[model samples]
Target: MTPKAARRTVRIAMNGVTGRMGYRQHLVRSLLALREEGGLDLGDGTVLWPEPVLVGRREPALRAIAERHGLAHWSTDLDAVLADDTVEIYFDAQVTSARQESLAKAIAAGKHVYTEKPTSTGLSGALELARLARDAGIKHGVVQDKLFLPGLLKLKRLVDGGFFGRILSVRGEFGYWVFEGDWQSAQRPSWNYRAEDGGGIVVDMFPHWEYVLHELFGRVTSVQALATTHVPQRWDEGGKPYDATADDAAYGIFQLEGGAVAQINSSWAVRVHRDELVEFQVDGTEGSAVAGLRTCRAQHRAATPKPVWNPDLPATESFREQWQEVPDNTAFDNGFKAQWELFLRHVALDTPYRWDLLAGARGVQLAELGLRSSAEGRRIEVPEIAL
Candidate 1:
């Protein structure tokens, strides 16, 4: 008879459950889902269980979330939770401005930390947090969930297989029209458009671009960007008008290591014309591929179609139909949940996990450089961070 696996319950103090990404992705989809599955099998003699202690500023909201999820633990005080020795891990999904202080507290409490990115509002603060986590000798990580998406996973597979030999360039388009609150209620929080609240497309998205480019291709060597606040006036949640001081749109050109150029446009003012909300097109010597959040398609050099550029005639080529869909060889789980399991294992078993706070600082660094480039109206070289 086979022996039963040992079960270990890990209490994680989760902050910012009131937020959209925190509630939906981290709590419901990831942690709670893991609990429902009877915890994660650690591929050894043990099974790792996740017990969440919901933390936030509002008691009512925290209590409501805890009750809805059949959880007994919820706290309005972060310090109270941090003081508990049983809470081995502290996860932060708070607003960008509030993140650094809370993370510092968690580190001070000797709790392992995992957090959402652009880890801090600025690069210096982010690096400080990273340094603190490193000195504390605690397991730490930042959310880089997009890398685990089905499309990016397939793209990684293609890269690993040398399908796109000598990768030349990458173009990325991301964003959608965020409704103004007056006529139609805003889709995002009002704070997202307020500069005082640490809001901007460059700050929000350049972090994502930084990790994606660095991990898949090479490190970003330089940046040229234009950040703009297209929608100047916007109504808040209370139907009150306010100045939108943050950049709603950002256009950037990044030079990657190995001479690859990447151009990405991120905007909240754009209408969708592509198949997905976000898409990246990569062109190489041997082939080219386009990938979105869930799908990836590739066209080999042999299958490339050529069309004569004649202004007088309408084009006859079905350019969209020419690409072949990349098959999902294996089933994909939710990206947030996947990373959660990995972090849990890293905590329980000391597994190899590389996406730490330092990696997160790199994201913040790119965001800062991108914004600086826009402000200075010139290309800015990315400096390597050491700590």
Candidate 2:
């Protein structure tokens, strides 16, 4: 709203803004915050304003979110919103099942597409959407927020600096116990436990792992996985017991394009005992580094202490103390907001973007392969997705 010199406004049809990820990360933290800062500077003195039009099914929730953010536009009718020529982009944050249908409609309606990951549960559906978007010749993107995370950024810096020398392996531990809704309200929605609603740990986390692994190291070539429903029964939001048909936990071993190996364990049934809810420890020839959500620590090979195999006896040395903490030399912005700005710039200034619909399809392919590996009880080779 600042009096800027000839700023252009990009009207974004933000579908599924009633959901948690959509509202908290996209609407509030990213879009509204950008608006509050007087929009984005395009580096040539002209600013790019992002005007988000909230679209959802529930009238009350949609009205509430829009009013709280002081947004002027919102509607329950998606078709009507898409019909408006002013709407340039359609962003989807809904369930995985709805991604293909919603995106196909948006692409057909001549609107650019942007969305959260796991574009579809099946590889075929995801590929179809990607091809559709490509055929439409409109701009598209998927949220790959982890790549812009501070801890991951620090790790990337170490890699770029050749601190790792030759990378060997990556071990990722991600999980936290979700409280059952019987005595305590569940943090996640009840539908997340149902397979019918396109909910599962492998589908959810594999998308993140795909981008993380691809961005940090290389492309994932194969996967060997075991997925299970740790907590089969849990109370729903309405205080009624429901069968948790979806897998709440997944253990995976991945083979990257390089000789390096990667293992990731994702679960919602386990308690947190490590440095953070999600942490990745990468080992290399020269050193090893462990990165959490906001921090990273590294230990050089020369500094590694020799430990005697005396597990039966009391420990003597502090293993964790050997690594030095990496300092925050620069302010880390919100990952989602940063990506949003980039996407805006991509739309406005025709900047290069890598996280397109094809990238999202790759995520879907990984999740599908992981599930297949679990079901078939074997390692599945990940083939390159071609249009």
Candidate 3:
């Protein structure tokens, strides 16, 4: 006979639900789906149910989204929501500049916090928020969604099993050509190209790279970065031209604490030639592997074919085909939802959650250092941040 499930609802005040990442990822993909699937099973019998109240500045958009998703609650006034006793958790996906202030408010209101990454515009701000959360004695977590990606998980498995011995280096290629919005509709929001609006490839993508590099190989010890604003002017959604003050591309080289070198090129101006929108290649002594969003391929030293340098002769060797595909032996869940479930469990069950504001601060630290490196035109040391 099946056992009965014990369930408890967690009321979460979700701010910035009207934005793109907020709506699609945190709301549609994660919270609503969790609500629809009943609740997460807690290994034993107890289950944690997610109850999200959409909060935003725009009442009409919030009401529409809430009504469409069959949500019972939404509010334009955050103060009123914070004062309510029912809201046990507060989540934010707001712009970088606004994150620290709102999250600080939530912590002061005695609510557990979960937020999207690059927690704040600066390391100090991020660290202050982390310190506040700790001082308030509330559970806190930051989204590190990329670590949960299926491809990265598989790569982690390989690393754990010693598939790649004595890892030498990592090469990450990410991005696609974003249309300048003059002749065609821009794929990304116009705010992404404006520095004043908290836009730039280094600030946007370096945080992700920081975590990925730290988790996969080791923590970054030093960084050398060069940033560029490829498209200086672009048309907005309303067909109005605007100056893009942020850097659209960043070329960075990092020295890992474990002595592994990692080079990453992040851009909105370059066309991709890889298998996915983003890809990472890890070269080691025993084997080499390449991982994308959902696919992973590897070649062991024994399987590697010898190739002689002969540019004069017609190249017949299929270098790409020499590598064998890694098997998908297990199923993977949606990254955003997985992290959400973990955060909910952390709040409800007192689970051990690792990705806290401190980790988020580290992400901000890397972005700060990367920007400094670019501005100074020299390699910058990454000092460990403590809160």
Top-lDDT structure, candidate number: 1
Q: State the displacement of the C-alpha of residue 145, model 3, in Å, after optimal TM-score superposition.
A: 0.8
For candidate 1, lDDT tens digit of each residue in 1-387? 989889988999999989999999999999989888988998898888888999999999988888887899999889999999999999999999999999999999999999999899999999999999989999999999999999999999999999999999999999999998999999999999998999999999999999999989999999999999999999999999999999999999999999999999999999999999999999999999999999999999999988789999898888989999999999999999999989888888899999999999999999999989999999999989979
**Alpha-carbon RMSD, candidate 3:** 1.1
Q: CA lDDT of 282 in candidate 1?
A: 98
List runs of model 3 lying over 4 Å from the truth.
Answer: none
Writing each residue's lDDT as its tens digit, candidate 3 over 343-367 gives 8888877989989999999999999
Give the alpha carbon lDDT tens digit for every residue of 161-184 in model 2: 899888999999999999878899
How many collisions between residues are there in candidate 2?
0
Candidate lDDT scores, in order, read 0.95, 0.92, 0.91
Top candidate when judged by TM-score against the true structure = 1
- Of the two candidates 1 and 3, the one with more favorable lDDT, higher being better, is 1
Better of 1 and 3 by TM-score: 1
Question: Where does candidate 1 have its weakest 10-residue lDDT segment?
Answer: 61-70
What's the lDDT for candidate 3?
A: 0.91
